[model samples]
Target: MIDETDESLNKSSLVFGNFAVLVVFVLLVGGVYLWVSKKNKTGQQVFPAGVNYLSPKGDEAKKPVLLYDFAKLAESSDWVTYKGKIYPFSFQYPKVLTPLTFPNDRSDAVTFKVNELSPEQSLLFTVETISSRDKNLVGKPEEFAKNYWKFFSGLKALNKITKITNEKGMTGYQATYVVKGKNAITSDNYFFVVEGDDEILLHIGDIFPTEGKAVLNRLVNSLEYKK
Candidate 1:
């Protein structure tokens, strides 16, 4: 009877050990499956599946280039003289000029007038060549800046200056200002005051409309100085 009892006890212990081993194997496999599933869901690793890496061929990636010709325009204008360097003023829309008159103080200075289509545009382009003596009398750039502020107190009041950049490409001191008031709008006015040179070129204008930007870009792109 004692021998039978011992054999039964040994069989029961072996069965429990085998059952525990099977449970541990199952738990390990389940843990690995969960880890892999979580990794895939979180996109931590790329799947071994194939991917299409090439960009589509139909789309042209190049930007359209703009071109302009100022010489051709200068030839057509009677008001413009070929003896001096020519500045181009070409636009998509027809521009009508208003009568221009010289200021009482600056009799030699010439001013050309035009009507701005909207409040957001400039209505005139003033170009003047100052003599060396006049430039010296007025003082250099620093003095001119001080005098400019004194004369145009509105400029100081509004303080719409966005940037004052040294535009070496255009060869001058470029001070950009945002216009104010009901008709006042944001526009670009380029002032080119060449150092030691008395001649100052002022290009005051508004940006072309979205539809006209392409043509305007071409016009500006064509700009060149006759040296």
Candidate 2:
């Protein structure tokens, strides 16, 4: 009789350890697969299937190489005008995109999305009201944009500020910045700063990258202020 009870205990312990190890191995494989699915080489990061976790990121974060053409937009007929209800301005967006007004009001801004898919998400469109009294924006939208970005949290770096003009021939400033995180990337998401009257400034950020920077260029250039 070679210690039968002790042998049984050792056998049970070995079985449990092996089971635990198997479970851990499975979990590790699943986690790696998920991460690889999320991040891509071209910088396109895909969000998991769900509305709660969906937000703009990845390839759209890269600073766009500026190659703006306004004529194509002029020739295109697939756009619809989104007039501001609270502000004295209007812009055009592609008909393929659906616009959702936040708070059920256009008083703030509008979010446009082709779908719930990530890496290529909504275009964050908003015409913000900034104080016109700020001396930074007195005559220079560029300065206003530069000064505005200073307070942007997690600002990792700033791209060269470029002078941009809209289709209406109104002047604005385009600026790009990188935020420090996997979710917020650097490059290509363009922010346009337009000087309002002596009491207001309009800030628009084109966040839709799936459709290409040309679409963003069209949207920015289509902006026209009635006031």
After superposition, candidate 1 runs with Cα above 4 Å error: 1-124, 129-169, 178-185, 207-222
- Model 2 over residues 112-222: C-alpha lDDT tens digits? 543343322333555544443364455554566666545544454554577766778877666665454545433343334444454355555544334344776677777
Model 1, residue 108: distance off in Å is 10
- What 10-residue stretch in candidate 1 is worst by lDDT? 47-56
Off by over 4 Å in 2: 1-76, 104-107, 115-123, 132-140, 181-185, 188-196
How displaced is residue 136 in candidate 1, in Å? 7.1
Model 2, C-alpha of 180: deviation from truth (Å):
2.9
Ten residues in sequence with the least summed lDDT for candidate 2 = 46-55
TM-score attained by model 2: 0.54
